[model samples]
Target: MVEAALFDLGGVIVVGPWEGFATYERENGLPEGLIRRINSTDSDTNAWARMERGEIGLEEFAAAFEGEALALGYRVDGMAVLNGLSGELRPEVAEAVRRCSERLKTGLLTNNYSPMASSERSAELAEVMGWFDVVVESSVLGVRKPDPAFYTMACEALDVAPSACVFLDDLGVNLKPARAMGMTTIKVVDPDEALAELEAVVGFSLRG
Candidate 1:
């Protein structure tokens, strides 16, 4: 039986920041979908993965991103761009996490960077993450998901074997490694459906 549930913060627990990127792109006079191009390009040496892995600090990341934008003939403020991309918490998901935490142990497993320490963001994050029994952030751990080590670290911190935990993430790529490591995994889409799927796996009603 699953003794704990691990959740990804962005996309899973909160509405993703895609809208923010759309706004940023529009304001910068860049072609629509520039963010997608940057994200999909292998040539873009500074991707979110590097930041998530703690391989680069925020200032370095912003500078590299700005350099890339300039090289592409897109002049814009990279810090403002990144701030726009950070997500907002979903109240329903926060409530679900609280209910789950009260019934069974719940934890957060997010691939995030140092900007999470911002006072404005921290207060918002605390309200959502406070519901979890253990919160594992990539920036703090110096490791990221899809890497077995990160998953192992989360399992260790939660004091649960991989098989005893149900892990939920919006990205299929992130969930694959966790499933391979013996954790029950859910790819979140619809929040209610996600809760149902999680309940089925863990054999507990998250709604109290």
Candidate 2:
């Protein structure tokens, strides 16, 4: 009965930036998770949120995020922290997307910041993005996940009802709204396990 499969780009389809954050923390001698703590403190109104919503440019975000960290008694470099967001793609997840696209609608729902320049995009990423039937980015929509409006927009884009969608995200916060709206939700902690669960729902083999 699932007509669409919705996925989150970071943490689910691709490797997440947590490892980068940890490395940054170790190199800077900052307290562990200090950057994440700052971002989560006023999540809805934080600099990270504003940047992802495309309300501010990268330079502005760097200053504002650094200021926020300083307010928390930590002198973290926001620009360096932002560098942690880039991660390699996960092939298994990408393959799953291709498989899902063969039979059902696939949507890429990502909360991401606008690239500083158009040249920041890569051919590889562009190719992977093509696999999605619909792509909804928070930077373009002015709404991010955990906001039901974002999920609603994605479903509407795919022309599917929420009850007929299966959503996957690494964050429970992002998945909660979708679940409440009647979508089947999966939290992707381990790629293999998450794909296993997806196979059960879609009744298809995502991994070869």
Candidate 3:
């Protein structure tokens, strides 16, 4: 039986900005997949992981990201790119999180940058976050998803064994590691399906 529930923020609690890359591409007149190429070329050179790890400040992170984009032929507004990558909360998933939080221990485990707290739009998401028992944001914790240390920190914070936690993440890459750590995992492709899967494991309906 599960003792706790852990959720990822982007693509799970909220719908991510699906058009971010396209928008940047359109603005910069870059060919399709340029962003992917950049990502592939320098996996650890970008500001994202460092920002999430709290190793760099927001301004520094933005400057580094913008510099990288400029090098990639994308002369774009860095803040715009960051804002474009975020979107409104997913109501179904938010409701499910609310329901779960009311009945059992709940936590949020997300890979995010430091600027999230300063974004005005983040206040909207904060309302939903207030419902969680523990919030393990990578920006604050200096750890990110797909890393065993991140999952270990979350498990420790919630006072639950990895095997007793049900973790939901939108990315299979992130979920794979959590599963390997003995946490029951769900890859959230569809909110309804995700809730159904959680209901199956937790033996309670989160839809209502």
Candidate 4:
């Protein structure tokens, strides 16, 4: 039986900021996915990875990211990409998380940097964080997704074996390691569909 449900924050719980990126791209006349390209190149050692791992601050990341972009022959605005990181919460996901916490160990595993200031967190987000039994952040942990250590830390925190957990994440890359470790992985494209898949795995209704 699944003993825990692990969720990703940016894409799984809240609306992903892809639309923001799209808008920024259109406004800047940059080619579509220019930011994504820079992020993916040398992904593990890139500015983004460093920031998420808490090895660099936002301003340092922006400078390093600009250098990476220039190396790729694009004059990308790293700060603009960071500005587009805001995502709206999905109420349905919050409801599902609340329900999951009632029945199983629930965790939020996210590759995110620490908030530069306390004001970065809102009341709604604080409430959502309460629904999770454990919240594992890459910046705090010094390790991020796709790193087996990250998954292991979450599993250990929940006191569940990988085979006894289900993890939901938006990126297949992030899900790959967890799946390999024997967790049932759901790649979340549509929130409803992902919740349905979770329901099937955990034998519970997640949607209202």
User: 135-175 in candidate 2: lDDT tens per residue?
Assistant: 89889899999899999999889999999999999999999
Per-residue CA lDDT of model 1 for 6-100, tens digit only, reads 99988887776667888998887788988756755653245566777778887887887777777777776768877886676777677777777
lDDT of 3: 0.80
Off by over 4 Å in 3: 70-74, 115-124
List CA RMSD, all candidates: 2.7, 1.5, 2.4, 1.4
Q: Where is model 4 poorest over a 10-residue stretch in terms of lDDT?
A: 113-122
Each model's lDDT comes to 0.78, 0.89, 0.80, 0.89
Error of 4 at 186 (Å): 0.4
Q: Assess candidate 4 and give its lDDT.
A: 0.89
Candidate with the larger TM-score of 1 and 3: 3
What are the TM-scores, per candidate, against the unseen true structure? Answer: 0.85, 0.96, 0.86, 0.96
Per-residue CA lDDT of model 4 for 3-65, tens digit only, reads 999999888788786878888889988889888787899999999999999999989999999
Off by over 4 Å in 4: 115-119
Question: What is the TM-score (0 to 1) of candidate 2?
Answer: 0.96
After aligning candidate 1 to the native by TM-score, how far in Å is the CA of 34 from where it should be? 2.8
